[model samples]
Target chain A: MTAFLIENKYTVGIMLGVIFGLASRILMLRTDYRQYPTYPHGRIIHISLGVIAAALGAVAVPALFNKDYTAITFLTLAAQQFRDVRKMERDTLTKIDELELVQRGTTYIEGIAMVFEGRNYLVIMTAFFSSLFAISFTWYYGLAAGIVSMIIVLALRSGKSISHIASAESVPVKQDGPDLLVGDIYIMNVGLKVNQELIAERGLGVIIKPYNPNGKATLSNLGQRQAILYDLSTILGVYRDDGEPALIPMAKLDMRDGRLAIFLLPQEKNASKAREIVLRVPILESAVRMPTEAKVNQQEGS
Target chain B: MGEIKAVVTMHKQQVGGGAPIFVADNVKQMEETAFLLEKLLDAAVHDLKNGTFILVKHK
Candidate 1:
């Protein structure tokens, strides 16, 4: 090796190439494998390819710097590794999501690689390969570098297409909307902060009413209005002690995040005139599946 | 327990010929309770689809 370096001073550059190639491969193996480990078989393929790539770069890069190589075996090996890495990507998605190719699948490996960006893998491979090219033609290394850079640019665009397909294959999307039954909902008070408020009930004295100081308050000692709850679907019908109905529209209804909250007031009150009326909203039974489906029916224009 | 920020309870109902039950809870417990229910439903649906729903006893 010393004799070879003495014969050609450029051989020193080949050492740098070998060092960079091995470093890139080690970095990729250490970081990338964890992101997609479901396909242990694919992991083996990628690692072996990286090893072969680094080894080929080690020999070819120095030989090329020394202006040797009876046959461009290292270049050929590097290309083969890149090609295999590209092919391994498809094997990762062996688990079929759906018959239509757009449904969700639990054990999707290709989708995982796509999420991490396949082109980045290619760019890393090309960076390793570039060291070999640098050894071959010291003057034309600039041109070789530009060519690989173009491939990286092109791979990025292809990665986007892969991402679209992979995302469609991986994500579990439901077609139907959420099951929301709004009625007979009673609000229960889970104690929040309380404050004193002057109460005036027509002829009644200035009795102090326990008011929840923050809007983040729950109803206290509340029981469900059974007759109303059983029949309710979306609208909460608030009634006074005398059974007089007050219209309350549910402002937010989500069971997973919390129980539904309804803003109630008289039907005659407009936006400016509406007074704050809080009611015990009914606790939603968590039987309904696909809660996120509710947002699908909402106005898209908003 | 400090100041009683919230209290939640589940309401169970038997339905669909099996002892498949539904849980009702207040807002504080709604989110987590619903997620658990969704998981249960997923298993139930999988069982029903595969004709294994009969093999498992009700909880």
Candidate 2:
């Protein structure tokens, strides 16, 4: 039993480091420090320092048996790795947020994108864990595990992040001009769930019917009225006389799946004309006769 | 995964005009690295504003 423990000390230590690394990442992410510098930075620094502690733990666990300078060397390397991870996480978030904010306001989607950032931490985590593995155990095993974990985490986080962002329901701008550009912004809440393929594949289409008192402004009337839809690409067509406007804004067209619906609206103030539609109430068909109020009242009485 | 070494935004030109870029790397650098990064990013942003940058990424 004692022998088994001795042999497995390094393995145990590496596992512990993995667990510690995961926890630290989560904590650092949760405690965003840039805004509340004192409080956030304190928490982040603690975690950053904790990473070194974790590396020491890895080295010490094996050192109990090996009792060599090798463990000491690894401890040094791991400490550096930990420091790198901490700095990366902090710097990336800070720089990205600064640039994004300069480009767009907090209310814009750019703020959310800039703020809810990741990727750097993920890469560092993979490297740190793998290094721990290689130093503690076989290099190949460590590399394999580290690579696998990194890929999995990246995939998972991407989906998760994307969905989270999407739920926020706004386009994050990294560059600025206007918030309401004449383009369809693909929304993904977390990294996992994305509407890119769906939006691109299906395209926008009329779903909600526009209101018209005489019922003359249905999508079919596009032949009679003028309408246009533009984007990175262009789609232009005239209304076919069915009450649908002649030009449907590409943004208004959406994939037919139950997931999304598309429709047109009048150009909102400040929005680009090429991208935005100016919704207009349709004039009543000249041929349609209106019933007299007296007749309607009589029908209601009966 | 190690922490991100650096997160740099780049710019890439598309058919229509151009767009700002995002480039992330995991390599460590010396003190001058930060200054170099700033220069690169600033240049990219300039291109984005001017509609000239075609593509930018971590080499």
Alpha-carbon TM-score of each model against the true structure: 0.30, 0.24
Please, what are the lDDT tens digits per residue for candidate 2 over residues A1-302?
64564466566546655554555445434433123223667456645555545455544544645667566576556546655654555564456545431111222222223323333344345546654665556556565766576566645452221111111121221112211121343211111001122223223332222222222222322321221121111122222122121112223222232121222222221223212222221121222222333577569858
Overlapping backbone residue pairs in candidate 2 total 64
For model 1, how does the per-residue alpha-carbon lDDT over A1-302 read when each residue is reduced to its tens digit? 64664455344444444444444443444323123433566456555555555455445555654557654565765565565554455454444323311222222333344433343344344544555555554524623663555455454432221111111011111111121122323221111111001001110101012222111112111122221121121132222222111111223323332333333322232222121112222221211123223465344425
DockQ of each: 0.04, 0.01
Docking class of 2: incorrect
Query: DockQ of candidate 2?
Result: 0.01
Measured by DockQ, the strongest candidate is 1
> Which parts of model 1 have CA positions greater than 4 angstroms off?
A1-11, A28-34, A37-48, A57-70, A73-108, A111-302, B1-59
- What is each predicted model's overall lDDT from 0 to 1? 0.32, 0.35
Superposed model 2: Cα runs more than 4 Å off: A1-116, A160-261, A264-302, B1-59
